[model samples]
Target: MAKDHTDPIKDLRHNTAQPFEAARAMPPSVYMSDSFLNEELTHIFSKDWFCVGRADSLAEPGDYTTCELAGQPIIVIRDRDGALRAMSNVCLHRMSTLLHGRGKTRAIVCPYHAWTYNLDGSLRGAPGMTRNTGFCKDAYHLPEIRCEEWLGWVFICLNEDTPPVAEQLADVEDLVAGYDMTNYTETFFEEHVWDTNWKVLAENFMESYHLPVCHAGTIGGLSKLEDMVCPPGLPAFNYHTILKDDQLRIAMAHPSNDRLKGDERRTTFLLAIYPSLMITLTPGYFWYLSLHPKGPGQVHIRFGGGMSDDYAGDEDAQSNFEALKTLLDDVNVEDRGCTEKVYRGLCSDHAVPGHLSHLERPNYDFAQYLMARLEEGRAD
Candidate 1:
């Protein structure tokens, strides 16, 4: 049976006034309905810049890995000369997916059609079609994707005509300028498949209103929830930020094993890039992120952490890093638990749009930005 839904945020107190007046009211269906999910995938996911993987993944020439960008199957590889390249994993002949996972592949081969492609996405060979009239070796190569690496992470845009990654993220460089990310190495990697819309997760990350309540045991006591500062709203290019207090910084920077003390301790600067990429950087540690939309009610989150290669060989540093990973795990558990419940309420008939506190204006801005992008695609 179709569920009856209502706004969960209506007739409630708002901590702030103006700007969000138009967004103060929206249906819960926006979070739980199948129709809404389909629209988001079509409009927002397909066209946006997406973080794919860490640059370290392709450390050598002929190194390739397969990943999906907003549901579009793509493969990234390091060519013979060590340049990184992104290409559609789909075969030209049968449209079958090409690469499967990470490895050193001399060339990408389609299992179904046996069409082969070079590391540069050029067609090398195709069995049984050497003289096919419709087939032109020059024009039958795999489709290439636009890709760029920023701060050690690989980002790809499926749309060939999309803006350059550096230009698109030009506005956010200052937001991340404070952290010394050069000290981090890839120490932790994780992914969570949550039963909720991607926007819900993104919005939750942007706001700290639930920290004191939802993360009481895990983070509430460890950080200042009330003083959390959110940068006005999401940017024109799909980015948002949440600034945590010194307490949160200390907890993350203090390595459990206590390898480096004194000046090593520093602040944690977090950045959320549009579509679905989250980067949490401290003076000595960092978390790389990639969010994939699985369905209206599901999202696949990819997270990776890296520390400086100098720290990579330090046994004490590696052990101490568990403290940061543990903290992140606790936060993730708390977040996923609450968001799952929110998903249930959004699908409930008793639900209504909830009010945003003045502190939650950042959350409001994120939602508005998302709605704008989603709406833009629907119009086009």
Candidate 2:
């Protein structure tokens, strides 16, 4: 059913405007309202530094991946000179979208008309345009989009005015500098469309308060309520910290790593890079989800993870990693179930938000972030 609220935007403001001790879950209508989602699409998704994936994933020239920002199709590729680039994925000739998924493409060729483009996004050739008086192949090319690499991750910004990826995430860099996350190698990449609002999953990751109950079958046992620490978030991101024991292996620093000391070696940082990138970075490994809303009811997720370079070569580490992957997959199953259920409850007519726990500090900050972004958009 469509949301029948008078003003989701007002409700959003009123809900997040409260003090931390008075914070409650945001009104469900904001998650279900078309107008609110459109506000987010315009303000948040369009103007933020959106993380796509790791840079090393496209090491070779011609390697590319496709994504959607707001409603515009985008392509991120490595050009002949080995520089990372982004451009409109739609063909200039007839507006057909180029590239579908991750792959190595010699050039961007439109499936609809076979209009060929160079790796640099310039027009290469066209099927049949020799007779058109107005046709000038040299004058046509795909519009370039801004792309950048911070550490080893690739980020695409739709709004040219948005801050550079490095500056926006500078605090985050300082937080995980000891792990040297750029050296982390991506071991797997997968995409999933879950039946839930994107914020539901984002909030789920923003706090560890749910780990004990929602993830009981898997990672639940690893975390305790007393140890979770949620602090106030910065303008560009929010984060929390939890301690990991040495027994978790990948969650702890490798013996060769001399950079981390004491708790620093075992602490796992849950970073919510604003808009929609949630990263779980520990001393030895990291995983992340880059989310996009499919609609009021679903979210498209770019899921991937990897091991640190410190674990570069060890047969036993490989064995443990495979086991770890299995465990993580189980954890995802638990999260999907929990988040989907939350969305269902939000859609209910009688749904009312409950008070937030102190452990939900990041989530409260996220709501405030949304309001701030929306207000900024309104000002523009």
Candidate 3:
């Protein structure tokens, strides 16, 4: 057992660094407005880089994968030279999907017109069309999206104009550099369609206020109720750090002593990349979450997990990690259930924007930033 000390001032300061202001309340309309969601897809999702899948999905040359981002279908593949590329899944001829599913395809073939594209998204063959007669094979190739692989993730941006991931996330590089994600491998992947708006899930993920109450049984003990804080000034797109009770370190195999016993063996450190992606890094494991906006109040969430390769062939370790994932899923189910109901409440006449607690600075700041961007979009 570890030593326990009750320091109210330290705990209060940790959670109450930000001052509360009632005017900062985020109206429910932001969550339930069909129009607002569309704006988000255009202004937010299109303007930012999103982590769509893991690099391992296309680990080998010729391996291809597919996903949907901002309501547009996308295809990702590793070229013959092992470089990753992303392209719109739509065929240029008939707009039909080019690739059906993931596979090691020599060349992606469209079922509609049999148009074939190389793994690099170059037009290889258009079955019946001649290369002459002003029909340029190069001009008919698939439209490419700016995609990059970093720390084992495949990130794609619909906008060819967004800044590179490294540039956008320059400030948090030191924080991210602390992790060794190279050792992790997939441990779980799950997709859930929710009745709530994407922001509802975003808000739910932005703070730990609900953890002590909503997750009392599962993570209540693992997280410190008062110490949960996310320092402000983090970049708009990357909310990479979640400060929780240092005691959660016990959950990891590592042992520690002192006021920051678990910081070294953290059981909870989640990152939310704006628009739609959340990643959790913990000792011996981690997981990825991809969020898709189906409508203003409907969203789809995909969950995937990874572990260090050193633990790869070990069934015992794998089983333990899987159990942790199950626990996380159970907690997520609780979050989803309430969020859907919140979406309904947002549309109610009695709905009112709520104030932000000092500890919920990240949630408040994120909402404010999103609103400001949307307002800018409305202006433009």
Per-prediction tally of clashes: 19, 0, 5
Estimate the overall C-alpha local distance difference test score of candidate 1. 0.67
State how far residue 310 of model 1 sits from its true place (Å).
7.0
Most accurate candidate by TM-score: 2
Ranking by lDDT: 2, 3, 1
Q: List the candidate 3 regions with Cα displacement exceeding 4 Å.
A: 1-20, 101-103, 130-139, 237-262, 309-315, 378-380
Writing each residue's lDDT as its tens digit, candidate 3 over 1-380 gives 00134232232233334344543446555565555567788888877787766788677898887878777899888989989989989988789987855678899888988888888788888877874587778887778888886678778998766778877766555565545565567755667789887778877877777777788768766666565556664554545344445343223423221212446545356666666677776655677678878887688777788665545565576566667777878888788777877787877778765667765666666665675566566676
Error of 2 at 362 (Å): 0.3
Candidate 3 lowest-lDDT run of ten:
1-10
Scored against the true structure, residue 356 in model 3 reaches a CA lDDT of 71
Cα error, residue 136 of model 1, in Å, equals 5.1
The best candidate in terms of lDDT: 2
Q: What is the lDDT of residue 119 in candidate 1?
A: 83
Ranking by TM-score: 2, 3, 1
Give the CA lDDT, 0 to 100, for residue 60 in model 2: 98
- Model 3, residue 357: what's the lDDT? 73
Instruction: Give candidate 2 misplaced runs (Cα > 4 Å).
Output: none
Residue pairs whose backbone atoms clash in candidate 3: 183-308, 184-307, 185-306, 185-307, 187-305
User: Per-prediction TM-score, please?
Assistant: 0.82, 0.98, 0.84
